[model samples]
Target: MKAKKTTPQGNKEITDLILDSIADGVFTIDQGMRITTFNKAAEQITGYARREVVGQFCHDIFKADICFKMCPLKHTARTFESIVNMEVNILNRQNQEVPISISTSILKNRKGEVVGAVETFRDLSLIHELRKEISRQYTFQDIVSKSKAVAKLLNILPDVAQSDATVLIRGESGTGKELFATAIHNTSLRKKGPFVAVNCGALPETLLESELFGYKKGAFTDAKRDKPGRFKMAAGGTLFLDEIGDLSKGTQVKLLRVLEQREYEPLGSTSTEKADVRIVAASHQDLSSLVKKGEFREDLFYRLNVMKLEIPPLRDRKEDLPLLVDHFVRKFTEKTGKRIRAVSKRAMKRLLDYDYPGNVRELENVLEHAFVLCKGPEIKTSHLPENLTPSNHRTAPQATGKTSRLPELEKQVIVEALERYGWDRSQAARELGMHRSTLWRKMQRHGIEVP
Candidate 1:
């Protein structure tokens, strides 16, 4: 009934109201790319009156960096159908190179004839300034954080790094344990020495032993030549033992001796070699709990726990999301050679609200995933992973950079489409290019009951 009541005048008023109410600048153009409509937001952003821009060419008004090549609006009008989230720097009326993210959608008539195109652009000048300030504030090697927990840890890291005492870093999987270890090493007295890392869980007990302590020639069947273990290789520097909880009891004894006597021997050699490396160990499993379970050596655990650093998960420090998002967007943009500059308000809202059980690594993966699907300068809601949708759960499989979970993704798209259409199944079906009956059937298949 509501859809039926949307007359031409009613629709125009609704469109005008939306454009005025929204914070992003919006404009429309005819098939010839002549500006047709300029919203209040556009007037404010570009410092131009709607009267002045209505009949002018868009390129003349904005002077976009991509007007000559890879123009998003041109692409949509020429061959492509839509342009969602293309970032471009445009000289405004003041001649300032203001960065803005533009999303374009083609307008069509009842007979599906292309009539015009509408564009929405959000000013990113303030965001850029804020990103610079935050970057200056949170800079610590490769670590970019704005959370109080990390800030406090960063404050003490120099002191922690100065000490030669054994350090134990604890956190969930995907948390940057080795990053902390490397930071400690880079800040320590042995900053110039090699920072060697070995994963105790990645090898069998024999291979791990050989891997930690260099084996003499003929130590094993394929022992071709002498090899220095991570400890010896890291002599005068730091040796990071990752997943130390996975070490066997026999290997634990060897490690405990290395900690106590400050020495270790190769696989086949009899004489003990001096252990000059500083030990920084990390584990996802709680070593204290492992000790209680009798799976870990209490003595070794005590030695490693001399200076413990627990990195909080992403959900605990969500205040860092905006900064982290910006950091990742810039990073991936460089790697992909794309000009993507920002995230849409709706997509960012979903990112802020969701619980990241996978922590910062998962966050990186999400952005990487977005960077792939996003063809424009911004990451839109439709570009995000399906599991990140409000209708999905964190436990759902991450379709990160892959189409492995197509059905789940399809369901989420349908749900989002329905929500966008105010839960009107007919409208949603029309937008999705499917029959209303098909939409209803798919909803039933996905168990999506409308409220």
Candidate 2:
């Protein structure tokens, strides 16, 4: 058999075939930034055909956010450098934003003369969707956590949401009780209806009644017109009463009446309006304890307590710190347009050492503070709040009454995981994203009884 000689045409055809076979979209642009060659993947990703995009301006076809401002091809051309895996957004033919990771390199002639630039981009839409799905597994609406206690609550949320029973949420201040309330409303049949929230503690007794039940025209000195209250606004929807424990006895009686009769009269008005709203009440104070002390109405407490949700404080679910930290970092990075990526080991250690008495809200504030102070890509020890620093606040004491060690924290988390999984190390290891053998070794090291 005679070996056939490869021709220039054959070589060009092979190159085109190879480019078209790749999963990533590939295109080349001339010095003037006009599209020269477009591959099959490029056509599919951008919703533009090869012939249609050929000879057109690259920016017009891509419509990337950085095309006009920070064009990657332009940067490569000027610096004689290459860009690898730069994440960016592009508008397709339908004007929908598509996330893509692009790599750019200079297209040079056989003589090494710069002729054009070539870009390869991979559609990140699927990746983004998968990320969202993974995030959803650990999240409920805006509430994010991976703790067993939270998971147990989340598992029961669907049933709770289906029921129209008044929901009572209990937690410490800044523990995101309102988030849980909102979650209930969002997941409930009243999702499409309005959600009105009122802080009972924020208003005085006189104003509280009018705020909850509204006031008629000329009801009082400030009653210029008939103003609808939170209940009226939340009609056919859900009403979130925050800090309900602070409601005065009089207001409590009125609220209890509405709960029982599903009706209330506006101040200075004889007509009663039907209370059609589903009530979701939240309080940092323990309503049971309040009732025991006669500070809260027992009947009203029982009414609101028909369905209850207890939010664990940050200190109790330290296992969720990493997820929460990442969530906030992304949140603030997008909000502040900072490039901060992650928390430093030292800073994370500092965070892990402290007992967050203020709970999740305080953690968010701490990160926000770090974001403001951090000029670099990562947050450092110096960027943390004063209280989180060693000099300002004493280290959190462990059961031994000394500074808590990372091992102690690890052991606690491991034990919790074991107990959560009914002492099934295999299942607990899977939930912890660790290997079973590794979990067993850790258990042995920590003296955790293996079952």
Candidate 3:
């Protein structure tokens, strides 16, 4: 054989350069599962040199969560199919758990025979950290939920809290509109200042105005001396206006001035006082509808809608029911001095099946009722309120058996897939045509128990 000088411009060298240039870890293994090629990224991410890792079995080089049962690369090689973004945790040389998303495909020779498998994995440590931070940051006070809808709201809530914009929390009655307003205030820059709350619907027109903007001496027959109103009480903080939709037309005009000019006059006072308080208004009714009906002031509606956080009703976030139930159980357990630790399977199923018209508030009340009845470590069906009972037609739970029907079918699919694939989640997910993470979430959501 004649020796010839070859440049790095060759296709093989160019391909190697491209692979090394990328950040994702890339490695190829032979049919015997021995590493054939290890890129620079693979070496960096795994803390293994190319010379050290090459020729070593992948399972030996990188210990992964699925190494024992559901190896994605092995599945890819056996099926000759590519797997994309299978999330798994692996231990690096430092023995620290590193989250990663693996994408794998079988390598074929020129004869179209499967010779080996190639895998590309990206480190998800930063992403996992961000997700954890989001969970910690968005949760304020006792507002806890695992539903993506709530999570999405919370993800942006920190930004909303940091600003001085007026916030309007709209949701169904008992959907915790006021709670959200409180959370906004508690998380805001004015957290150190006082938070004054008032129910606009609770007071009549004459009393409402006087209550909001305090009356001066002899302003009314009962007025004896000058008094500070909610605005004054919440100076440099937040004033939570509950049920602002019920505000009278006259009051709305005054509120508009306070929003526009950032100033308002006290009852019977000619001079205006600068309003330093931030407004966080809440209403179950639609202010936009009120505007269309010529009831709520158009300008006032815009002012209030500057920063709207419309919370989803309880029926929409049923996935969070279990978490809410747990929270309530813990709360009542502490208050009543009971050792209640769990809700029975039947009781939990019933709770999940119910359409919570009153939202999270109603769930709390139901748990309180259950706590009063339950004297054991667990909450059973008997401990549940009569309204939560299946016989109670007013609040039917699983009458049509369609409440958790989707999840039930989904569970069946996962179980069947697992059985068919001999308990290989990687192969099952591939057969089901879903990302491994998506399958995992679905499994968790459906509460599928493996054999």
Candidate 4:
């Protein structure tokens, strides 16, 4: 049987039906820049009816950010080229700024004469919201982690911020102590004020005191002018003193004075200036141990330890490894404009097996090195740093016979106990005759996540 040829009217109806069925907004403009056709999706996205938009000026209806400057449709029409997935913001009838990605193509007649242009645009608001939601899951105030240890600190951070007491943050190097300090400043009542940070360990003994308390003109050979110190610069906000344990004994006396009396004087200056900044200190060394050894001043330690926070090292919080890896992948993707999907399973296992001596900072560097070498969507084990090889993995002492299966048996028992108690870690810990922290640590070691 021969099929009858469809008429022009039937073809026009079919095209209109297809346009209405599309998920993206579709519209066409004439040579005069007037809307010639508007589909159902266009009306839905712009909050305007087809009848109201047809024959109207495209710019007047669309109101896109680039309508007058570098319009995609105009560019396509003039260059005889197509623009695909160019992101732009547009104002809807409700006057809301809606993010959308638009593609444009030149519309031509049968004789190859350019008569108009067609554009297809998709709403990106939902995608942006989803990205924000995903970011919030493993991130708190820009500090990324899913470990219970970090979560516990985050829970009390608001109260700590409100207290305005001197804070001493203890953590290994590269554990993101400054991030916590910044979080405290950002959440405090003085959020609108400035935040100044100085590394006590990074400066020399002579420069450290002058840096913290500034120096008057002609105070020393290098004294140029009267300069404001970190305390002055951070007057209404926070002054983060990093590696406070490195401060010399004499410098510690000055710092203790400032903390106790809230006053200090610049070198070669007679009068004292009132200090108004909140102090947040960090130290990688154990201050208590240093105090016992007479290396760190006991008076200064007592003053700085008012509201203490201890950040756990990356090795102890291995459960956050996957979340941190995914975060770095997303971060580097944006920074390098590469569309990396994920770290491969084998590569992730290699990452999980390693004990990071340098903590989160080392993990970030490892991922960044992988990003530089990776050309594909997934980062493979081969792309990791040479030092991350399987040979460098931490191994337990050699055990023979029944002892070899102890870890496997222990993991199985823990899993069974947690399952039997409805995944209530406390209940399971009690049932297993272990402390909650011990059970939690075991769970992380076994790679168990809450279901």
lDDT (Cα atoms) of all candidates against the true structure: 0.85, 0.86, 0.83, 0.86
Greater lDDT among 1 and 4 belongs to 4
- TM-scores across all candidates? 0.60, 0.60, 0.58, 0.59
The sequence of per-residue lDDT tens digits that candidate 2 reaches over residues 28-130 is: 9999999999999999999999899989999999999999999999999889799999999999989999999999999999999999999999999999999
Residue 184 Cα positional deviation in candidate 1, in Å, after optimal superposition: 1.4
Which structure is stronger by lDDT: 3 or 4? 4
TM-score of model number 3 = 0.58
Residue pairs of candidate 4 with colliding backbone atoms? none
Ranking by TM-score: 2, 1, 4, 3
- Candidate number achieving the greatest TM-score relative to the actual structure: 2
* Model 1: lDDT to the true structure: 0.85
Expressed as tens digits, the lDDT of each residue in 1-451 for candidate 1 is 4557778999899988988998889998998889998999999889899999998999999999898777677778777578777778999889989999899887877999988888999998899889877666566777888888998888888999999989999986656888899999999999999999988876789889988988998988898999888889999999999889889999999999989999999998878899999999998779999999999999999989999999998788888888889889999988999999889999999999876645676678788888989998889989887767453453265757755665776687789879987899987765554435446757888999898
lDDT of 4 by residue, 390-430 (tens): 42332344444554554665687679879988999987765
* Candidate 1, superposed: residue stretches over 4 Å from native: 1-136, 390-451
Clash-forming residue pairs, model 1: 85-376, 85-377, 85-378, 86-376, 86-377, 87-377
What are the root-mean-square deviations of the candidates from the true structure over C-alphas? 16.4, 12.8, 17.0, 13.5
Q: How close is candidate 4 to the true structure, as a TM-score?
A: 0.59
